[model samples]
Target: MSEYFNTQALALSKSFADAAFKAHTLAVEGLERVTNLNLKALETNVAATVDFLSEAAEVRDFDSLKTIFPKGVNLVKDSAEKFYANGQEVFGVTVKTGEALSQIAKGSFEVANDSFKKQVSAAQADFSKQVNGAAKKATR
Candidate 1:
């Protein structure tokens, strides 16, 4: 009985550890994806700003200024769209990671619950057998 309990305890411990590791891995991967997306967005934004500045610096007359103004406006619009898209991507990663973590937790809980039920049923059966044997001996 002691050995059985020790084995069960070890198994449960390993199960929990495995679940934890999986959750951690998923979270890290999601974070990595978000970081990469942000970095890319930053790079694009910086490049666009630099280009716009360079264009403005080249302005020599009112006509050139008019062209640069429209370009600047377009840049702002494009940047806003990119920002929104990046936000959506990050949200998607977060939701996916959360769902995966939830699944890991749920699976661990179910496994532990089933193990506990089996142990209880076995213990009850063993107790019942012992009681019947004792009663028979007493009658004899």
Candidate 2:
């Protein structure tokens, strides 16, 4: 009876440990994805901004450039703001998710550690009992 209970408890403890590891892994991966995607988008935006400046600078005529400048500036402003807003939104979501996952992992670790300590103590007690029983039998 004791063995069976211990076996099932062990399995439950292992599942808890696995859940903890998976939670941590997901948090790390989620953060990485958010950071990578934002960096890539920002890089593209910067490059495009630089290209726009270069082309605008090369304009030989003010009337022609003026004809183009307003639309170009507006386009850059609108699209860049959208990209930055999206990056912020995604980054915030990832941070929140990661924090929640981290908390779950921490809780799981505590539960697993407590279960392990109990299991070890029970095993030790059982060993002591068996040894005392055997010595008494031998003395008799």
Candidate 3:
């Protein structure tokens, strides 16, 4: 009886530990992905800014300004397009992370539910057997 209880306790403890670990792993992965996305976006924007500044610095006179103005406009347009694309990519990552986390949560819940059901059924059977044994002893 002691051994049985010990085994059950160990099993429950292990299940809880496993569930916690899985949840932690999923959270970390999602955070890492978001961080990477933000970092990439920041890096791209910084590089674009540096390049634009360098081009603008080259403009010294009215004729040079005229030549640089169209290029500056094009640069702005290109930067806007890049930012739009990056935003889309970030959105995609966010959606994927959400779905992945949801699945993890759902799967863990189902497993825990099944484990609880099985434990309850087993306990009920054990209780019934013990009661039957006590009744036989009383009759004897």
Number of clashes recorded per candidate: 0, 0, 0
For candidate 1, lDDT tens digit of each residue in 1-140? Answer: 56557767877898899999999999999999999999999999999999899989999999999878989999999999999999999999899999999999999989987887787688778879989999999999
The number of residue pairs in model 3 that clash at the backbone is 0
Where is the poorest 10-residue window by lDDT in model 3? 1-10
lDDT (Cα, tens digit) per residue for candidate 3, span 1-140? 56555766677667767777877886788778878877887898788778888988988899989988887788788878878887888788778877877776677667767776777778788989999999999999
Q: What order do candidates take by lDDT, descending?
A: 1, 3, 2
Residue 116 error, candidate 2, Å: 0.9
Question: By the lDDT metric, which is better: model 2 or model 3?
Answer: 3
TM-score of each: 0.88, 0.56, 0.78
lDDT of 2 at 63: 87
C-alpha RMSD for every candidate: 1.9, 5.9, 2.8
Q: Which tens-of-lDDT digit does each residue in 76-107 have in candidate 2?
A: 88667869787787878787887778777777
Total backbone clashes of candidate 2, pairs 3 or more residues apart or in separate chains: 0
Q: State the displacement of the C-alpha of residue 62, model 1, in Å, after optimal TM-score superposition.
A: 3.0
Q: Give candidate 3's whole-model lDDT.
A: 0.79
